[model samples]
Target: MDEDRIMESERHQIEQIRELDLEELQVEEVENLHGSSDDDTSGRAYRDEFTFDAGLASLHTYLGEVEDTHHRLSFLDSGAILNLPLFYLEGVVLFPEATLPLRVIQPNLIRSVERAMSLVDVPYTIGVVRIYRDSFDGRLRFASVGTTAEIRQYRRLEDGSMNVVTRGLQRFRVRRRWIDVDGAPCGEIQIIQEDLPLRIPRDAFGTLPPLTSVSSPGPSHPTMSNTSHIKRQKCREGKNDFDADSEDSFESELSLKEMRLHQSAVESCYGCDTIDESTSSDDEKNVFESGGSQDSVTVGRSSQSNYQRNTSDALGVGRKAISQQSSHKQEKTRMDWIIMRQTRSHGVPRAFWPFWVYRMHDSYCLARKAADMWKTIVRAPSMDGFTRKPDILSFYIASKIPVSESTRQELLEIDGISYRLRREIELLENFDRVRCKNCQTVIARRSDMLVMSSEGPLGAYVNPYGYVHEIMTLYKANGLALIGHPVDEYSWFPGYAWTIANCATCERQMGWLFTATNKKLKPKYFWGIRCSQVADDMR
Candidate 1:
């Protein structure tokens, strides 16, 4: 009976543990529920293989005669000169490529867009200028050859700007600009038409010395003349192939595919030390076995071997050239850095930007010279003073130095500034401290220190007491003014003045103060009283 009872107790404990475990799992699942929702919303899969049709399905009506010759011959004589006002902006565009969105913000351009849209038939004579230089003088210079852009979609903004998308059709040369002050820009442009030759020129196509008859027994070296001829032929052919159809394919489809394939091949080969040498041979053999002509067998094998050897030699030469170039570039960069450092150390401001560096250096030099002159005139305290220092000397000198906030900050950051400035600034700081202490003592002795309540601009009552505090003496001449009344009770502040206090000992101004108006604290009537000599003497 005891054993049976113990077994039942064990089963009851197991049941309780399972219940606790289930409750914990339920809580964990509840927490994960929110995470699962986020997972569902995030990391959307993108289509990996996307293709776009870039070729023109039909010949555009606006396009002129499609030339079918080589050398990109344009019928400049037959083409009409379309006058267009050009606004230039820097960006790249290829022929037969359509940019979807562009924002035009000029006033004349907006009018032009409106006029163009209002016409029953859209004008097909828009000229594009490749922006070269943007100047402060409001004049824009452009490249000689610019693509012709055809507006597809035009929209006007609330702010009188126009948004449009233009497809670049062809390139043109600007003949002349006729500026219409009241209307849009008008310019005579020569439309460049491409009519490249289909075959290589007779001069370039001269029988390449019959390629040294590759079948003949020789060193198996491709002759320089043959190579040169092939290279020239390729170049000439490339130039001749620059037609609209060729351009469209090259710009939009084939070039992109080539780039992608090249990138993939490079990435695949990355970090690979060895390539399978037998792969090319096996491929060639397979082709030969798969019904390749007997005449092509020897020629094909030699060509394949030659290609492989050439590729290896080229890669080796490229690596060596790259290493040499990298070493030269590093040396050049180091030399440039050293030159920059030396220039900076000599107190010459290093040229950072192309044009503005010299201007900045000139401004700094002028400011520094003025600061030096001002330092000579100002006398600061040598020892702790019982009486205040004279104020005019400090005020006059500090006012003369027109330093910017950044320059002042740099001045303040100087290590051992007091010693560096020959105790000039230190003395000035000490003078303010002494003056404030003396003022406090005098007010305390006279029982004139008053606590006044005033209403501020925000309709809040503030109670303030008169306690003299140290104010930087240099600030007084540095566009700092005091605001308050002259007599009774006043406060001294920077950049607003009411009453002035002069030192009795030196007959020089000391500091300013703001006094309560009509013996009552009012926000508007309260202003600062300034005294330069008194503040200096006290210091």
Candidate 2:
């Protein structure tokens, strides 16, 4: 019977595998089970153990095969040289996953791929590089860590570009970069052999009781059999007074009751049941009174027409007290709020002031200097305005920008500044012109423009033009929240849009209009006016 059962299980496993997609089948699965008997009594046990060892053995053998097959894999030693004659791209691959298709466009890269494909029967092994542009120097930089990609399929395009499929095998880091005699980029790279961190299993804690029930006391009373009628009457009166006063004097009385309960719990471990009964009665009475008093305060405050005059001062004091108590709960929570406030006051990093102040000082200083130069260029009148040429790009080129790619990328990415502003600034710097008569001196150049609605109550400004909708979509997709519904109207300039958005629940101004005039906006703008505000409140 056991033999029959094992045979049935083997058949079932095969059936399951047959039903799965080709891509879903891991390499170990295909190798170990491909020709296994469907009738062996010990097949299941044999397969598990066999597959485990087989998988590891296969991995080592596969690595060896890859190394022998691709010369690039051989070069991937502690210090292996790499040639990146064209665009570098970051690639990620899993061992059990299949290869991905790629298109090779650059001529030098094409030759490298062709050479590898011709040399190896498996046609695999190439480096992946992350592309970044330095902000200061406007030079391209690649991340050190990269994956080894193996070519799986190759197709030649009519234009000579090759379409290929490749799989990542291992990770490598660039150790040193150099230029070939012909000016092509090359680097010495090292294989990174660190294992991933072990993940601990999560411990499960059971659910907690509801806060309401936990805070309240159930019905319980203490009485002695020998108590006199008079004493009993006195106790009844006390209980009645407790119940009556509880509603009006709960907060103050509850504190005292809690203290008494703590002391009682500490004093008598043997008579815990009796002490608990007494403590519950006292606490219940105090809690009832406190709840009522709090309700009254809320009602009174709401009923007043002049909330500012009648309740602001009291609310302010109450808020301060609450905030102080909250601060005692967790340091991280307090720090988070502080950081949030700072972020709000400063604006997003590198986009606006105060917040931009926190950015790399050099970058901030450069941006500010650029802004000033732009202002001068825009305001200064050109001598013979028609013939004079502006030199805006020269300012950027002259700044001796840092070699950091991220900084240069940010400068290149800034938007919302008008071409007119750029041109005016350049003209001012080049030809010495003053501001046009129609434009105010206060009118900032495009990059320096603050696009925000006039401050007012929530819903005062409705973004009819759907600028806020677009901005919100871009910001939300990238995980951002804009606070404040100061005005109900929408404001749009050449490269910027503004509208007020407030948290629906708290009514606190969460942020101003979403700002996106960056690299992420192109596709969003192409989609045209989709109302982002109409989406569910993500907060």
Considering every candidate listed, which one attains the maximal TM-score?
1
- The residue ranges of model 1 lying beyond 4 angstroms of the native Cα positions read 1-80, 91-94, 115-124, 134-140, 157-160, 197-539
In order, what lDDT does every prediction score? Answer: 0.31, 0.30
TM, every model: 0.26, 0.24
Q: How far out, in Å, is residue 192 in model 2?
A: 1.0
lDDT, residue 397, model 1: 27
| Candidate number achieving the greatest lDDT relative to the actual structure | 1
- Per-residue error (Å), model 1, residue 200: 6.2
Query: Which ten residues in a row are the worst by lDDT in model 2?
Result: 197-206
Query: Mind sharing the TM-score for model 1?
Result: 0.26
lDDT of 2 by residue, 1-539 (tens): 12234334433443343553233322111111113223333322322231112122112121112322333333244444454322254211112122333545656667767655654432355555556444489565666555566665456767776655455454566777665554445565666543221111100111321111111221122123312332344355443334323422432222222322322322222111111211111121111111223111111111123433534454446545544443333332222222222222111111222212222222222333445564332222222221121123322322111111222223222331223233323333443111111121111111111112111000111122111111111111111123222121122222323333333333222223433344433211210111112211111
